[model samples]
Target: MGTLKNQVQLIGHVGQEPQVTVLENGKKVAKISLATNENYRDSKGEKQTNTDWHQLVAWGKIASLIEEYVFTGKEIAVQGKLTSRSYEDKEGVKRYVTEVIVSEILFLGGNGK
Candidate 1:
C-alpha cells in the first residue's frame, strides 16, 4: 500500500464569527469560516489577491476556545484532517460539504483585528 495521509495545516484569518451549537447530548460543536489568500502580480503586472474560504469544525474543548477567542478577522493556525460528507437538506435535496475537522489550533499574529 502507498504511504498516504489525510492531514491538513493552514494559517488564515477567521472569515466570520463562529457558530457554536450544543447537541442534545450536551456536546459542543463550533463551525467557523476561515479565509486564506495570496497576493501576487499577474502577467500584466497588476497586483491582485486571491482568497479561498475554508470550513472548519471544532469540538468539545476546542469548540469552547473558538466560542471565546475566535472572531472575525482573527488569525490562527490549525492542524486537522479533511472530511467530506453528504446529507439531505430540508427540501430533500442532497447536499455535500467539505470541512477540516480541527484537532489542534494556535493563535497567529492577529488574534483579532
Candidate 2:
C-alpha cells in the first residue's frame, strides 16, 4: 500500500490572541493557540471534561488574514497538516514542538461584533 498521509481538521475556540511576527526578509508569520474540549462521564459516573491545546501557524497572505480576523475566544475551523521541528533554545538545550500549518480557516457564526 502507498504511504499514508497526515492531515488535521479542527473546530475550536481560540485560546489566546493571534500574534504576528515579521521577519527581516519581509515574511509575515502568525501564531495562535486553539483549545478543544471534550465532555464525558467517567467510569465512576462523574462528569469530566478535558481540554487540549494546539498551536497553529499561518504564513504570507494567510498570516495577514489571521491577524485581521482572528481574536481570543473566537470560534474557527482550521484544516491543515502537521509539522514538527526541533531547535536549540537560548539555554543550548534541544526543544521540540509540533504545530498545525493552517492551509485554510473559516470563521463560524457571525463576524466579531
Candidate 3:
C-alpha cells in the first residue's frame, strides 16, 4: 500500500492568547489552541453541542501575523499538516505530542485592535 498522507484544515476561534518565541536561527514560532464547536439537536429533541480543540503551530511570517493579530476569542482559518514529535519530560519519561504545522492562516471577523 502507498504511504498515507496527513493534512488538516480548520476554521475556529482562538482558545487562548498565542505564545510566540524566536529561535536562535531567527525563526519565529507561534503556538495556540483552536476550538471548533458544533451545534445540533439530539434525538430527544433537545439541543446538543460539541467542541473540539486543536493545537496549532505557526512559523516565520505566519507566526509574526498571529503574534500581531491573534487573541483569545478571535476567529481564524488554518491550513496545515499534522506533525508529531517525541520529547523527554522533566522526569525523563518520553512524551509525544501532535500539532498542526501551519502553512496558511487567515484572520476572520473584525480586525483585532
Candidate 4:
C-alpha cells in the first residue's frame, strides 16, 4: 500500500516528438505529450469522444529510452508518479504545471524506431 502512493499509470498515444535536453551536469531529460481518449455516450445518447493531454517527464536512463524510441503517434505504457511545480513565466506571471515523472515504459503495437 505504501508503494501505491502518488503512483500513476497511463497507456496512450504520443502527441509529439520528445523534447530532449542535456544539462551542464551531463544528465539527460526528456519531455513528451501524451493523449488519452475516452469514448462514451452523451445525455442525448450521441456518441462522443473526449481527449485529454498529459505532460510527461523522464530523466537519466528513462529519458534516453524515450529519446531513442518514443515518437509522435507511438503507443506506449508508462508508470510513474505525479509532481507539480510552479515558476515565473517571461511575463512575470506565476505558472503552475503538473507532470508525470516516468519510471518505466513499455512500447505497444508499433515498430519502434
Clashes of each: 0, 0, 0, 0
The runs of at least 3 residues in candidate 1 whose Cα sits more than 4 Å from the true structure, single-residue gaps closed, are 1-4, 110-113
Sort by lDDT, top down from the best:
4, 3, 1, 2
| TM-score of each predicted structure versus truth | 0.90, 0.90, 0.89, 0.95
Worst 10 residues of 3 by lDDT: 1-10
State the lDDT of candidate 3 residue by residue for 1-113, as single tens digits: 35456768899999999999999999999999999999999999999989999999999999999999999999999999999999999999999999999999888988766
Predicted candidate 4 versus true structure: per-residue lDDT over 1-113, tens digit per residue: 77679999999999999999999999999999999999999999999999999999999999999999989999999999999999999999999999999999999977866
The better candidate by lDDT, 1 or 3, is 3
Candidate 3 structure lDDT = 0.94
Q: What lDDT score goes with residue 2 in model 4? A: 75
Task: State the lDDT of candidate 1 residue by residue for 1-113, as single tens digits.
Answer: 36458989999999989999999999999999999999999999999999999999999999999999889889999999999999999999999999999999998875444
Pick the lDDT winner.
4
Compare candidates 3 and 4 on lDDT and give the better one: 4
Q: How far is each candidate from the true structure, as Cα RMSD in Å?
A: 1.9, 1.7, 2.3, 1.2
What local lDDT does model 2 show for residue 90? Answer: 98
